[model samples]
Target: MTARVDSAPADSQAEAFKRLYPDQYYRRFLSQNTRPDGRSLTQTRPASVVLGVITSADSSALIKIGNTTVIAGVKLEVLMPKDPPDQGCLQVNVELTTLCSPEMRDNRPTEVPSFLTQQVDAAVRGSSAWQPQALCIQAGRAAWAVYLDLYVLCADGVLLDACVLAAMAALNALRLAPVDVTDAGNVVAAGNDAMTDGTSHPQQPYALSKQGTPLTLTCAVIDDRLIADPSSEEESLAATVVSTTVDGQGHVMGLQHAGGGVELSTAHLQQCITAAQDRHTDLFRVLSSAQPPDH
Candidate 1:
């Protein structure tokens, strides 16, 4: 009983030390096969997704993984591409503001936003989540351009994963509004008397192709150990980071690797794919639940 009472003070002192030296604290936790946040190396924090957060946009989704939060919104515009007027365009942008993290408090640009935009764009377009040709109003005339915008509300860790998820969910929840294509190659709202010269098209909701939904999961290589769904703190100390995008059919869509000095082995890459597939199962469950019944 006496020894236990004395240990309480020692534990309190250790806690204080951890707060004072976070890097060392995290190392100590990793040495014991755990993280400072009480998660194992391969485990991720609580995640959730909600659709239709922004009423102004055609479709939107808000996703959260632990303290990190991201929201995605889509807007449709009429684009007349020179080469493939039959195929619509996909514009992806990622915005980071002071509201996301202290690093952005100065209002300077960082590489993170562009990197995130590339990852999300590749995952959605490369995976063919929705066929661009389907957006065509008339051959060689006009097509719908999808504007996918992602905003980071918080950046605790695994930001790319959250952003990709939000983008995919928002695109998945998107429903194309009925429009009329005028002879002058202009698109206007359907059933509007102002655009009487245009031909009205039947309302068709946007839907994902037969291809399964895409999900991107991020992993960090820390001290030569692979950890999936790393928190922002862990990502900071990582030697390398890899992101794997997979579909519900367990198909690999895209892979992104950042940072170097430590080369990842083939086995590690395979593990990342496996981890993404398993995580995809869980993510899809959340996405399916968030989808509207009409879709």
Candidate 2:
């Protein structure tokens, strides 16, 4: 026979209990229709975007989604691809260091979400955030390759969402000096635009043709409930995670299972898409308001 206590758990006792029984502690909160972070099942944390944070990079932006922070920097290089000689290329690399999370502190090393880069890459390319034709300096001769590097400075969770926001904001904030091919077969920027290394001066900026910037939402299902923008703690307890990437126009750019092999129902998938679309409205507003050093 079990006896029930009338009094609720003390805050300090609850905290200690959470430390000892993490899974049960978290599930206790979830059973009450909320998360440990105090967010509703469908709620997401606040987000912010800051542009032109890195002076050395061609373009850069820092984005924060709750505690998760990601900084994206881009450098434009000239290249001629074998298949698509005239089109420009976009290379994305995402790195999560030890500073971002305690799990990465040991020498053993921790693997980040393997699909985060793929999700952001698919969204960026599919949406034409950078136009292939615009990247070409001369037809089939020379083209621009955008190297986008994203660093996760904080690891609260919803990593893909933060990374995608950083990448999109950085791409749109790009300001490059006009460049042309010289008689010596060298590409040079217009007057006073290039440094000794032939890279565009950060002061002289030209806007790149960007469209359909992406906003990604990651939802975790636990106890048959969908939770949006789960924190790292919540992610650990999830049965599965589904990421939905959408544009400002509510068009779905990409969708995938980011974690766990557990299958989700059609309704759950639709719910994620809807959440992403709603997130786009707020995030796009923030992106639009970003102020770069130059136009």
Candidate 3:
């Protein structure tokens, strides 16, 4: 008589191998001071920004970091403020489409996207990047509400960093159109005649300051090696992930850490901050080159 046996499925076997031997698998590449993608420790992926991709939006930018791509659009709306409304309001929304990756679902708001939206909002608010008063048409009566919408076309990891950069670029490219209040107290777009009239508000268009914009840098810690801008595969193997936002003046605007694999020391944290500061110039150069010239 012959005995019948069942073996583990290929998918299950592969998953088990990764779960059991991830450290060892990653260590093989770390020993050579390289990553699976052939990038050295502390090396970041290539980044690029394109401005004015969406003509309908007041401002728009498309940013790509490695294979991850994020598009941000800014739209300005006039709103009547409630009591104690002294400053303009900023609203941010992030969408992670299933087309970007298999892990995401269609038309569903996932945890990652929600978390990224909050982080981008905090980064903007914490840095005081936009002067709310500048957006005010009339204190407590009327103000501009800025809506920033971010869409992830591809997610290869380092999502927060890409989103923040795209948002900053879009805001930098924004140009506010002149607005006028009618006799009936309704806000309307200033026509050519109104633009020439001295009675119209003499507000000049302005853009966000590049210096106040903050850039986020994400690092993945694997087997005691810190890798900058980790890929999706590397992120899966990471023991700790740290994201730090730095302004152009080298000030640390925000810091966040996730994962339970490793505890980072103060020195290690400082090292990450320094690395982020060092890369600020390169990112700023990309943003500057993509901005539209002022008319």
Candidate 4:
């Protein structure tokens, strides 16, 4: 009888190799205080933003960090809140399409999208990024609900940070048409006379306080080395990942930690916060310089 040999399944083989070698592979670069992509441990990738990408939306922006791309669109709707008669509402949704990554499926439910949406909601709400009252056209009668939809066109890593950036940029570019409150308590679009120009006029929209704008920075811990804005491969090999958000004035807005490998120290947490603060200036500059897309 001939001896029979069984080979490991392809999936299992890949997983086994990742389990065995990724740490060593990453460590070789970490020992030099650098990443395989030639970035220093605390370095972040280049980022860019383009505004007014979607003509249909009240406002839209696309942001890219490294190869990760995210687009955010804002749609304004009139609605009355039941309990909060005085304040308006902001609803945020995030979607990762299959075109971005094989891990995501078309129209399939996933926790990641929901989690990202909630994270962005909390970040904006927790900070003074937007005043809900500004969206309220009439107390208890009618108010503008801003719906922010974020789509991930590419996923290199740092999904949450990218989403938040896109949302902020889109909101900054928003220009709302003036509305008139009728005697019947109906919200109607203002006439062309509302604007000095006869052409499709743009009105000064509800704007977010620039000083209150929030920026998020993500750090990955590998072999006790803290790396900022890790790539997808680095994230997979990380022992723990921490995401921290800071406002323009350097106040911590939100902090989140994931992965099960390592326990983070208070000192390390402070380092992450400091790094996020340092990144705020550069991020704000990028957002400010972002030009509206040419028609």
Candidate 5:
């Protein structure tokens, strides 16, 4: 659950209530008829996605859902793990920079990163996007682990939605160099931990596993109005709900509710799903059309 702002406050106390306990007000909206943005129960906000924004990364993308913007980078590395030799792990991290929002500060670790990263890790692990066998070396002695890093360059609303979309696009644009393994099973790559040893190794590049159909889509609520993407101001005013759904695939990768007043009904939930299905064309188009940076 992310945050939200309730529209059509009934009174001054209700307005204050929307502030003091937005989650509760958000719930009231869901139970009532209208949403905060004056949208139908099934409407989603506007969204746009850009690919290969970072020239230096192996793969990168920027996605803006409403006013929320997220940047994602994916880097590939070979390593030896103490456990699960046959399975390559996916690691994700999030950094909410100060430029994203005034609420985020230079003080302690921001809550957005911890929450968004957890969702990303779960989504990648649960989806059939990556195969551990593809990352295997000699049936378990070594493997390759992919790290996906996300940075909140800006945050208007629905950080999870933008981050997840950017992450998928970045992964699709990723290209890993060749891996060399001798008969002795000694694997090698001509690079340091940063992959900048500057020595080119002779090996053929292999494609990664096929990405799962229909990536997850996130929808937040600003009261009864179930906005496909909410901006930061909208988030600040209501109780927010983030539902991660893989349309057509119909898998609920993740679901989180944040804020104070959002009350969702079963009917509203169904409406959100319908909205996500409608957005799939745009989402998949952005994911598949994303181009990788030239190395």
Candidate 6:
């Protein structure tokens, strides 16, 4: 059987560009309360998420918010901690593949990874998503350091939101085996234990902390449209405000008035956060729909 292919018509690009970037004079004159996409000021783009799509990964997730798509994979490795020997660490990296966008090239320098890393680090640190104590095998000794890799195969708008959602979903899908430490303080595996069988092993206490919510939502500003999850063209043509609020819980982390030239009012900023909270339902549904990863 031949694989089915889906694609936009030839005129779609032109149409999209036209829709995003209207004539200069008209754009300047159109100071309507609504957005160009006909969405309410508090509406967010539609989002879909899938988990455990990758058969070989310990945990993985695919997120689609409007035209943007991102995949996040988690890999766990046991290594000795430097300063905090009793605690393991988590390293998160985000890569914007060349195929995703023209701006991301093969050999060129890209700050995307660093920026995303910082954001993820902040979120992870601020929230008690992963217990550092659980990762430790021995006091001032060996532990597990989880490596989270995020690849942006496509980015239309709101890359930060996609990244955070993907990361959280991956964390949820994770099921690692328990690690055993030898008398020499080296990490090893136990025999015949389901939680530590040398493959996709997860230890006991398979739970997240209750201090903070699961994920973050990002809101951006495109022209006069304060949109959640902006498309690439929309992102390019307007000042942006990226804000994220955890589910049920209030806003623990947020960044706004980014990329210069746009000053969002306190009222407008609150509107954006409120919009994100409404969208959080969609995010929750997507996460709830995913099945546990098969290791």
Q: Give the Cα lDDT of each candidate.
A: 0.84, 0.82, 0.84, 0.84, 0.67, 0.70
TM-scores, one per candidate: 0.88, 0.87, 0.86, 0.86, 0.74, 0.80
Residues 1-295 of candidate 4: C-alpha lDDT, one tens digit per residue: 9988889899887667767898776787788888878989899999999999889998999999999999999999998866789787889999897888767756577798988999999987887757787777767777788999999999999999999899889988876567766668777777646533232323444465545789899998887778899888898888899999999889898999988857998988999999999887888899999987665
- The segments of candidate 6 whose C-alpha lies over 4 angstroms from its true place after superposition are 1-41, 192-211, 222-225
- Cα RMSD, model 1: 4.2
Best by lDDT: 4
Candidate closest to the true structure, highest TM-score: 1
Itemize residue pairs with steric clashes in candidate 2.
175-206, 176-206
The best-first sequence of candidates by TM-score reads 1, 2, 3, 4, 6, 5
True-vs-predicted CA distance for residue 27, candidate 6, Å: 3.9
Model 2: residues with Cα > 4 Å off, grouped in runs: 1-11, 107-114, 192-205
Error of 3 at 216 (Å): 0.6
* lDDT for position 201 in model 3: 61
- Mark the 10 consecutive residues where model 5 has the least summed lDDT: 190-199
Higher-scoring candidate on lDDT, 5 or 6: 6
Candidate 1 — what's its lDDT? 0.84
Q: Write the per-residue lDDT of candidate 3 for residues 1-295, one digit (tens) a residue.
A: 8987789899887668767897776787789898767889988988999998887888899999999999999998988767557677889999887788877755555688889999999988877566776677666677889999999999999999999999899888887767776666577777656543244465566565545679999998887778899988888888899999999889999898998847998887998899889777778888888857343
lDDT of 1 by residue, 136-166 (tens): 7766777888899999999988888898889
RMSD per candidate (Å) reads 4.2, 5.1, 4.5, 5.4, 8.7, 7.8
In model 6, which residue pairs have backbone atoms overlapping below 3 Å? 156-232, 176-201, 176-202, 177-200, 177-201, 177-202, 178-195
Could you tell me how far off, in angstroms, the CA of residue 167 lies in candidate 3 after the best superposition? 0.7
Indicate whether candidate 1 or candidate 4 has the larger TM-score. Answer: 1
Expressed as tens digits, the lDDT of each residue in 21-41 for candidate 6 is: 564422543366455567655
Error of 3 at 257 (Å): 0.5
